[model samples]
Structure formats: structure tokens, C-alpha cells
Target chain A: DAGITQSPRHKVTETGTPVTLRCHQTENHRYMYWYRQDPGHGLRLIHYSYGVKDTDKGEVSDGYSVSRSKTEDFLLTLESATSSQTSVYFCAISRSGTTNNEQFFGPGTRLTVL
Target chain B: DQQVKQNSPSLSVQEGRISILNCDYTNSMFDYFLWYKKYPAEGPTFLISISSIKDKNEDGRFTVFLNKSAKHLSLHIVPSQPGDSAVYFCAALRAQPSRTGANNLFFGTGTRLTVIP
Candidate 1:
């Protein structure tokens, strides 16, 4: 609802292949994030960027990489797709990545790996 | 370790009643908490948030109460409507000011709330 859109709302890939998901926002927010949601696991942060060219890993960053070269876009890449990595990927943004900032999420991309 | 935990996997509430969802966090470094509502085919949306400085925060029919000593937080919704039925996720924000890293949110296994009319 925050002018955020995640491309390829649904995707199917095979194991060992690389997959990239795109998150685009018209909010022009300074902070962007990527998270994965799974059954029983809820949602876990994968990566976040405070600004363009500034990105860092999150708790589940082992198989993921991210890049943010602009304020409106953040991309999440799966280096090598695995069945265990299949999940619903969500992108979020906030005016500021501060403690009090509330995040707005995009319609998730459901990725399936076979 | 699961820093944030939601004990209840699901909760059933009746219409015109109050629905209370609870969450607990083990990390003391967390300073901000938020509740999000998600539907079947959509991403989680921001419902409300509370900072560590206050004990309670209210927005219309929704209220969030925080207890620092026990590291517990609860979200209260009055007059639960049928549309209120969805999965609720509680998250805690961890800030690291020393580094250029952005703050990250730790989430709990969401609780699915069903409102019966």
C-alpha cells in the first residue's frame, strides 16, 4: 500500500539456479529491506539498505545477496536456489530505518524451487 | 535462537468481543516493537508500533501495551470484526548505531486470529 511493488509476484526455479527478485517503491524512502516468510517461521529479515550503495546482511543472509543503487529500488538475489530457500519474499521500506520507524511492505513474491 | 516468540499459534474471538494477542522478546537490546496483519495472498502490513519509552500506545480500537521488565507486549482490538481475522506478527527492532548497518527486525511465528460472528 505504500507504493511498493515486488516484481514476478510468482516464480518457479530449479535448484542450483540463480534467481533475483526486484522490489520497487515510489515512496522514495531512504530505507529498504528484504525478508522471507515461511510457515511456522513467520518472517525473517534477509538484508537491508539504509541508502544507495549501503547494504548489510540480516540473520538469514547465508544464501542471499542484495543491492541498492537507488532510493526507490532494492534487489534480492539468491546465489544458488535451493528447495529450502523457497519462500515468500517481501520487500519493505521506511522513511528512516530508525527505531521508531514503521515499515511498509510490498505484496510478496512467492518463489518455488523444484 | 528465536528472540521473539508468540506462544499462541491461533486464537479464536467472537464478534463484538475484545481480542488480545501476546508476544515476548528475549533480546533486551530491542527498543521498538510493531504488530503487522497479513492476509492469505498479500504481504504483512503495518498495524501499529510502540517504542521502549512508553508503556502503552493506542490507535483507535487498537491498543498496544508494553512491559519492559517482563519483555512482553500485547495488542488489544475491541469489537473484533470479521475483517479483523488474519495472521498477526510481532516484531522487535534491533538498532546498531555504531556501524552503518541498518536496523533489523526480528519476528515471531505469527498467531492466526479468527473472528467468529
Candidate 2:
């Protein structure tokens, strides 16, 4: 397994409150990604970082934001949590962001906004 | 719209039987395809992949077949076992320039497979 860990494996937050999920990796990978998984939607990328301080929006980036200040840490924040944002958030890392490289995932964080 | 589509929501197969999962895509630009397996409450793990230039790729009991003309792909698991029961996701990659790292991939709705013991 890859040296990846997600903080707050499970969380319950009130609607309109701020929430941040953390992804920490020890592999020193260059690429880090944040994804949310929902029924019938599979896993949709919210944001990804190619390097420190470099990030890009993904398919479902509307209600989420991300930051990568260091090579080992990537954070996902829900500015103001909403009930619709309830889902499993996953953090992934890859040695390189190429078709030939496979991304490894960390244990997901399940967030519930009530 | 979903660029990758997995029509089946769930499937059941007897142990030792061949299990086939199908996926389709609408984008012609997709040049790479991959499958990931996920157990409940855990993150998905990469299973197998096939490039657009190849029709098939196999590793152990897993085989991936791609048909570019039909924009379809299928995963075959021979002698399926109960351990193989999990949700499978199909993902597609559109190759982009190397500088930008076009690793952004489109995923389909997953299909849950239950291998009966």
C-alpha cells in the first residue's frame, strides 16, 4: 500500500459551517488529487495538484476548494458546507501524472453535512 | 453528461464462473482506459488498464478488452471468486501535452459485482 493517510476518516458537520479534510502522503509523489464519490456518480475529481502551490480545478469543483502548500500535504475545504456535499472524499497520489502511471489512493474520508 | 458510462448497476455471478463487466465511452479523444476496484468504505484500487492501440491486455485472472471503433471496453475475470466481489469503476484518459500532465481522467458510474460463494 502507498504511504497515504487521510485525516478525519469520518466527520459530521452542520450546514453552512466550514470543513477541511486533509491528505498526507509520505511517498513524496509529485501529483496529488482530491475526488468525491457518490452513488451513480462514481468518483469525480474536485481538484488536483501537480506540484507545490500548483493546483487545477476538476469536473466537480463547484462547492470545493484545494490547496497544496507542501509536497506531502493536500487539503480540501468546503467553504460553507451543504447537505448536498455529503459524500466520501478520497485523496490520491501518483508518481507522475501520465497515462502510464497508476494513481494510488488513501483511505477515504466520509463527510456528512446535516 | 457522463463521458464514460457503465450501464449495469449490479451483477451477480457464481464462483468459478466467468464474470464480465462492460463499459462504453462517447469521447473519441480518450486514448487510455483503466479499471479500479473498490470495497465498501475504502478507496478504489487500480486493477487493470489497456491502451487504445491494443485490443487486449491481461494480468493473472483479469483481462481488459478495448474496441476503439465501438468505443467500448470490457473486463473479464475468469474463475471469479468471492473475494472479487466489489464495485468496479471504468475511467478514461485523454492524453494531453506532457508539460500540463494530462492525467485528468473521466470516470463512469461504477458497477457492483457480487460473486456468490
* Tens digit of per-residue lDDT, candidate 1, span B2-117: 99999999999999999999999999988899999999989899899999999999999999999999999999999899999999999998755326535677899999999999
lDDT of each: 0.91, 0.93
Provide chain B TM-scores across all predictions: 0.96, 0.96
Mark the regions of model 2 whose C-alpha exceeds 4 Å error after superposition: B97-99
Candidate 2 lDDT, tens digit per residue, A26-47? 9899999999999989889899
TM-score for candidate 2, residues paired by index? 0.98
Best model per lDDT: 2
lDDT tens per residue, model 1, A1-114 = 699999999999999999999999997888888999988888998998988888888879999999988888899999899999989999998777556778889999999999
Writing each residue's lDDT as its tens digit, candidate 2 over B12-99 gives 9999999999999999988999999999888999999999999999999999999999999999999899999999999988866245
Interface RMSD of each: 1.7, 1.4
CAPRI grade, predicted model 1: medium
Q: What is the TM-score of each candidate against the true structure?
A: 0.96, 0.98
**Residue A67 lDDT, candidate 2, scale 0-100:** 91
